[model samples]
Target: MKLQLRLSEWQLTQLRQQEQNLQEEETYLVTALNERRLPMGSSSESIARRLTTTGAGVRAVQAQASRQLDQVRAENRRVKHLEQIARAAAAARLRDAEARALEEMTNLHAGRRDRTATTGWLDSKE
Candidate 1:
């Protein structure tokens, strides 16, 4: 039996989307910082502090997303490993069952009466 991994495709897609969103957010934050850094009359100290804080927030979120993605990937790998082990065990069980059936058939045929044995005994008696 083919076993599906525990991690669903939708879940993986969501994780990837979250990672992408985090990267986009980081890019937006950096772009905003760069635009503000230019002497466009908004390089005031308070604005600089606010942008720094926002940048820090973006970094934090990106780090969290990276961690989540790593965890999800690790869980997927673990589940895949377990599925492989289960499949191997199932195959081994099937092989064992087939071997047992073949052994039984061999034994059954060996126990059956042979026509040669019966005819030879009758011929000797005659």
Candidate 2:
């Protein structure tokens, strides 16, 4: 669980970093598209295409980030559930062990009582 949680967190961090980078790329592309002058050999059509492609890239990263976030939440919930199960199991085992110990103690004392009754301790033949 610890390893899974750490991996999920790492993936989320990576997705966030990707999103930030995509945002910067989209911003730069939008700025370029808004320019009036056509740079060197680049045409307006090419600039528009770049902006569209950047928008698509941004959307893809956002979707990926959303998926990663969901995975993280699931991993967290799963870990908590597993922990609860482990705790319950441990508590049950402890209860069983205690019950057994109590039973053994009762039997031991009962045997001593029987033995003492059969041969009186005051008679020194026990």
Best by TM-score: 2
Write down the lDDT that model 1 would get: 0.67
Q: Candidate 1, clashing residue pairs?
A: none
lDDT to native, each model: 0.67, 0.85
- Model 1, runs deviating above 4 Å: 1-46, 114-126
**TM values, all candidates:** 0.59, 0.77
* lDDT tens readout by residue for model 1, 40-115: 5655565557656656665676676576667667777878788899999999999999999999998877666566
Question: RMSDs, each prediction?
Answer: 4.9, 3.2
Supply candidate 2's per-residue lDDT for 124: 75
Error of 2 at 70 (Å): 1.7
Error of 1 at 89 (Å): 0.6
Residue 75 lDDT, candidate 2, scale 0-100: 91
Clashing pairs in 2: none
Which has the greatest lDDT?
A: 2
